[model samples]
Target: MLQTESEINMFNASLKGKLENLSLSSFRDLTILNLSNNALHGTIPSHIGSLTKLGILDLSMNQFFGALPLLLGNLKKLTTIYIYEIGIAGTIPQVIGYLKNLLDLVLSNNFLTSSISLTIGNLTKLTSLYIHKNNISSSIPQEMELGNLKNLIDLHVSSNLLTGSIPPTIGNLTKLTSLYIHRNSISGSIPQEMGHLTNLIDLAMSYNLLSGSIPSTLGNLTKLTTLHMGENKVSSFILQELVSSNLQTSLIPPTIGNLTKLTSLYIHRNNISGSIPHEMGHLKNLT
Candidate 1:
């Protein structure tokens, strides 16, 4: 029961409307509810799940639509569930696997279509899972029960419509460090067990329909600093924009110049070719 910051910035009106139900439900020992950047519309009131000592629920940037409320997963002392983008359409309510002390689940840009619910491997104390730009199409099921969410660390779903591949139990999230799935429609080839994610640092998959030949074991992700694999069907290219997407194949793994903390290297349109590897000039923190 603590409301300050100007009474939660007067329910932070970004302006839309709705959420009327709880006129603050007599603050039943309210734990912490932040009405994030609001344009709040309606729905969400499954009697606010009787706010059973709620831990932290942020109805993020709102224009809030429907679904999402399985009485807010029966509020089993939820541990931070952030509903981002507001326009939340439907699905995702596998009663949120009963919230088991959830760690930080951000539903990212919503309009949720459905399918991601494998009861999300029962959130083994999840560590940060963002649903990425939504419209969720499905796929990413679990090549090993989603590596049992071993204290996952930031797994952004990336732009939606997700198709498949990438779930080699996500190399069991060896304490993952930022792995954005990239614009969707995901295809195959990329699971060289993700080089066992040596504490990755931002590995965006890039536009979809992925093909093959690039994983020189991701140069073992030497704490990479942002590597967006670029458009797709990767193999061999020299697109000055488009020469019939000229295809052929291979090269570029000069052990990715041992990723000297790269500062963003978006591989360019795909197909890839030879010799630019002077150990990528030892990266000197490549911009």
Candidate 2:
């Protein structure tokens, strides 16, 4: 068996032809492929789908164009796929659902559009995902589609045009550490379900349209370090209005004192009322 399937790193080679002669049948045992920072141009070959043994594929900082190859989903063992700033346009293929073993998926700073598909929920093993800074417009899809990514850790999908509410099911990502969905058009109350992310460290959802009282559930995140939830309508004005109107929801549950690890906290621009509990002094780590 050809042992060529071990590691093929051609990062920043300035190679041209845009994958024209990039054939892989001979390298059936291939595992890692890094072609980042190159001059490669043209459509990704469909034959790429046949590389079932590939684990890491990095094609970032290239000039590749056209829609992402659907055949990419064929690589079932893929652990990481970085396609950042590749000039590739088109919606993320639903076939990516096949990568049950994928760990990281980065496709940021491109011209790509469309919303994340529900099929992404199948990547239950995903850890780090960075698909922000793209034109992927529209609200994030419902939790019924991607609430199963329980192993997710760092999710940075900021700087997009994403609308809609933060899905409560996101609490299912109990292992999350850094969650950055800021600078979007997301509206509505911050999901109390978010409190379940006990492992979370950094939570940045600022500059959005989120409302309602900050749920004390967040205090449950004992590991939290950075919390940015500003520029929303969650102030006491809205809170009092919501309470007087008896529209929906409750108040901060004093349980917030549990986040002893928190260092940076940004809760301005909201309608949050009530006096700061003395328990807040227990946060000796607060900065």
Candidate of highest TM-score: 2
* Range of the 10 consecutive residues with the lowest summed lDDT in candidate 2: 237-246
**Cα-lDDT of candidate 2:** 0.77
Query: Runs in model 1 with CA error above 4 Å?
Result: 1-18, 32-54, 58-63, 66-79, 84-103, 109-126, 135-152, 160-174, 184-217, 221-287
lDDT of 1 by residue, 65-127 (tens): 878878777788888888888887887988887688999999988889877888778888989
lDDT values, one for every candidate: 0.74, 0.77
- Which pairs, if any, clash in model 2? 5-29, 5-30, 234-270, 234-271, 235-270, 235-271, 236-271
**What lDDT score is found at residue 22 in candidate 2?**
79
What C-alpha lDDT does candidate 1 achieve relative to the native structure? 0.74
Error of 1 at 243 (Å): 21
Cα RMSDs, all models: 15.6, 4.8
Q: List TM-scores for all candidates, in order.
A: 0.34, 0.84
Error of 2 at 154 (Å): 1.4
How many residue pairs clash in each candidate at the backbone level?
8, 7
